[model samples]
Target chain A: MNETSAALEVRNIHKRFGGLEVLRGIDLRAGSGDVITLIGSSGSGKSTLLRCINLLEPPNEGEIIFDGESLALRRARDGTLVAADQQQITRLRAGVGFVFQNFNLWPHMTILENVIEAPRQVLGYSRDRAIADAESLLEKVGLADKRDGYPAFLSGGQQQRAAIARTLAMHPRVILFDEPTSALDPELVTEVLAVIRDLAEEGRTMLIVTHEMRFARDVSTQVVFLHEGRIEEQGPPSKVFESPESPRCREFLASHL
Target chain B: MRWSVILENLPQLLHGAWLTLELVLVSGVLGLAIAVPMAIVRCSRFASVRAFPWVYIYFFRGTPLLVQIFLVYYGLGQSPWVRDSLLWPVLSQAYWCAIIAFTFNTSAYTAEILRGAIQAVPEGEVEAARALGMGRVVTWRRIVLPRAFRIALPAYSNEVILMLKGSALASTITLLDLTGMARTIIARTYTPLEIFLAAGVLYVLITFLILGGFRLVERRLNRHLRPRTGH
Candidate 1:
């Protein structure tokens, strides 16, 4: 894809926690409408990379360019590349939606309220407008009837879907899923994946960190294999999954799949 | 003791009971106002912001309420600096001294209770709020504080009831609250058991009222979590 068409670009990102290096000089590019699946072992830093993209965990060193804007390198008063300010980082974050592995719905709020809160508070949308938008998103996720239900009252899969709707309500340009189905029971995984598949079909730009190899192969346009804090191999799903060029990718996929 | 004497002195006991209830109400409200903010500060990321309440809680929770009252009333009176200060006008009154002591003591315990509650708010919820692009202040106000208050409610109610009992300490500072009035009545009539029992019964009634109020608040907070029957 052309540089201008790419929704997110990560260049030489490095992240460390104390003595451990989690992400080591990772470079990636994802275009609009691309569904990229990041598959890796537990300590492979796929989730960390996704978090860095949203500034949830700021990278130790990196450049993240989103929508033609340099998110990592901020323009100083003298027009040089400095660190991004809090306001700039927050504006960048608002454009990206995130769904956690554990389905982090606000247990105290009703599903409808959870969906509407960000729009009303962050996006500065009118309460009425936020409610209307939340309702539509909830309907799309098949959760319109569960509007007043609390997260505790909903099943795990249902809560994850509601969380997706909550993210969608903000009208984010890209959505990141960090093992969104990993916390679900085996039987419930399909339901959550179904909602996600629908999102993929609708051409929502997505980066998913998941272990479900079959789903990743079927749904993703590109699949990246992260091994020991580096991208071992990445390509279109057919080439990566069916005919992986790297032995490390083959070993990783063999163990997981 | 004769039932008639008990019946006759009941009006005096009720008057004292009213004063006791007023003291508790005033102190409990003021104590919570101080405690909630103090708790937030104690949990703050900055060490400087967190230190003052830590010292306050350590001082009050470590010492007896009686000692605090004595220190506020007698100790402050003994200090030449305090005597010369503008604060002396407020400190000179026994009622103000009692209020100040009760406010300080209860606030320490309440702050600890609220800090535990705030900590009990799941890390996941805070992360979710942050991912939603909520600023720190908005996240705390809308999500963290409300939920933390709910989690802290039972403990806070217990503290309120404890403060109600603690207010009896105010009588030591020479405030003519319930226990003080009871002491006066005992001195005049030489009926200690009769007066003390009356005060005890009034306290029990107030405890019941606080328990009922807490139940109402708990129900309102948990309404969303309750299961629906018809659907």
Candidate 2:
């Protein structure tokens, strides 16, 4: 895939925690309507790579180009790559929404408040416009009726769904999911996955790090298999799942499948 | 031990109670103003910036409230520089001195309470705020502080009650608050038991009012936590 034309592209991203390198020279590209899944064993840096895209973890060395503009970076006095301008970072983050493994809904706020907070505060939308948009997004995630309810009052699946609606309220160009369903109960996982499936069907640009092999196979157009901080193999879902080139990817799929 | 002495001194006691209320109201407002900013400083990521509040909180929290009042009223009064300084007019009066002391003392405790509450805010929630692209000021104002203040409410109520009782120290600085009026009534009528009882009752009544006020705030903030009446 041509990097320039993709909605989001990562080139040779590297991240290190003291002596431990978490993401090693990772490269990824996603165009609009692309559903790319990152699957790997524990500590494979799938979540780290997703976080780096928004500079949440600020990759030690690499380039992230969102849409057509490359994220401007300057080496800090401490030798870390930080956004050259904070306003630029905030603007970039507004376009790249992140959904955490733990629902992370602000418990003090109602589901509707959680959804509308970013749009009103960060995006500076009027209250009426934000609430109007929030209701529609909540409707999309099947949580319109739960709008007035606090996150603590909701079930795990419902909270996750509300979280997705919150991310969508930002009108982001790319959505990153970090093990979205990993924290749910067995019976609840399907409910959240169904919402995600609906999002994929709607053709949202998404990057998902999930362990659910079947769901990944069904929803993702592209699949990347990571092993020990490096992408071992990547291709179309059928190619990566049915005929993984790397033995590591085959072993991971064998166990997970 | 005449019951009629209580009736005769009722107006005096009420006047003193009003001063006591004023002291608490003014100090509470001023203390909160000082504490909120200081608490934010206490929670600063940099150690150097945080150290200023650290020393302020430590100095006030370490000393006795009575001593703080004494120092502000008497100790500061003793200095020639303090006497000649532009602040002398305010510092010379027992009422202003008492307010200053109480404000500083309660502000220290309030700042500590707020710092703990701000720190207690969940990391995930903070991450969600940043992930949503909120600037630091907006995040603190809209997300961090609202939740932190809610978490700090119970502890803050305790501080308010303590300050209400602590205002009795104002009498030591010669500000005719409730306790001062009671002491004066006892001096004139020599009925310590009756006068002290009346003062205790007033303090108890004010404490209950503050408790009830905080309960209302907590209820409003936590309304979403309550179950909805309808499906």
Candidate 3:
């Protein structure tokens, strides 16, 4: 309910598949430079909430507010809430960049091309300008030399970094990390986590869904525990990680940590 | 049985091969033009949108090319309606009719091949493009179609070669293509063996050249898949 500082807000998100509900009503907010990390057991809908925030998966109910504008919504004939304006949805997606767990970089394009594609195509940036910015972003992620290589040629950790660079190329106001390190090998996890830590130090507003309990505790300003598709507990990392309120949250943390 | 007859008729046979190349080249390009959009539509997510293209692909693929040629050439010629239509001039010529038939015929096959390739594009990549804010058209243009074409290059090369051999059927429609020239030389010289053998040689050579051309193109498109040289 604190509207003054919140950069992104989601209210009462309810989602369902054909027969099962994935997310019950959930409310959370991240002010500027806030790092909110969601942690829970596998089927607890940790990932679904992030998907709904960007309209990658529209919630059956609830609205997402980004940059102070609520997405225009209307009811369909079948009566599910859908985005009424496609352009607005696209604009919102561009502003809210997402890093997938699988590192879904387009395999056909080289690393540099992958990094520059959305900027040139979606943002209508000139090719040279996009390339220059992409090169720098890649360099920022310590991937300047691999820019010419294909995604298949890179390691999983390297690919994840490139994906982060790709998302950063869009220059989004808020970046969502959906289990970004889950797909990485154990040894490579540290490399990707290190890059994300640097971003955290730079005052980036990020919503991360991660299983690395230690990294999550160290990086996040607010820690949210999801259980059965609902926010069971949410607070500062010190309080939630050390002395949690809900028994389920504590049990889940004990099992993961 | 005179082996010298093939040597003497080489010029005429070469001219016939030239016409055959023209038919395949024009129709193949036209077919591709039709197939690109058709394939895109063929893979539409909605069953309703896929209905028409599915039937069209089925009809062309289910029937033989010879029959398709006859339907366009003889069947259309029989209709007084077609004769009076604006397309009659182009339709009246066997050459144009053969091109039209071949274009439609190959387009169906090419579209089907491309549809499979497009569908084979990784579902994750499409979602990735969407997540990056790419519109459907831009995604198809930049990500989907280009990647699909890469995956499709080998199968498409096979289709082109088949079209080359299929162009021999053009002779049945009274066009003096490669096979047509062979039949003509047989009639005049009464030496079917030498003339047919000579024509077969030309077809094989053309097929070889087509294979090489596609190999080079495939290499260029698939350079990323291969290990980078100069290491």
Q: Which regions of candidate 1 fall more than 4 Å away from where they truly are? A: A72-83, B79-89, B225-231
Under CAPRI classification, how is model 1 graded?
Answer: medium
Off by over 4 Å in 2: B1-4, B226-231
Native contact recovery (fnat) for each candidate is: 0.54, 0.74, 0.58
Chain B TM-scores, listed for every candidate in order, come to 0.93, 0.95, 0.96
Q: B145-186 in candidate 1: lDDT tens per residue?
A: 898988998988998898888888878877767788788878
lDDT of 2: 0.92
Give the Å error, residue A58, model 1: 2.5
> What DockQ does candidate 3 have relative to the true complex?
0.68
Kindly report the docking quality category of candidate 2: medium
Span of 10 residues, lowest total lDDT, candidate 2 chain A:
A1-10
Per-candidate DockQ vs. reference: 0.59, 0.70, 0.68
Give the better candidate number (1 or 2) by lDDT. Answer: 2
Please give the distance, in angstroms, between residue A219's alpha carbon in candidate 1 and its true position after superposition.
1.2
Q: On residues B12-54, what C-alpha lDDT tens digit does candidate 3 reach at each position?
A: 9999999988998899899999999999998887899999899
Which residue segments of model 3 deviate by more than 4 Å? Answer: A76-79, B226-231
Residue B17, candidate 2: how far off, in angstroms? Answer: 2.1
Estimated TM-score for each candidate: 0.94, 0.96, 0.96
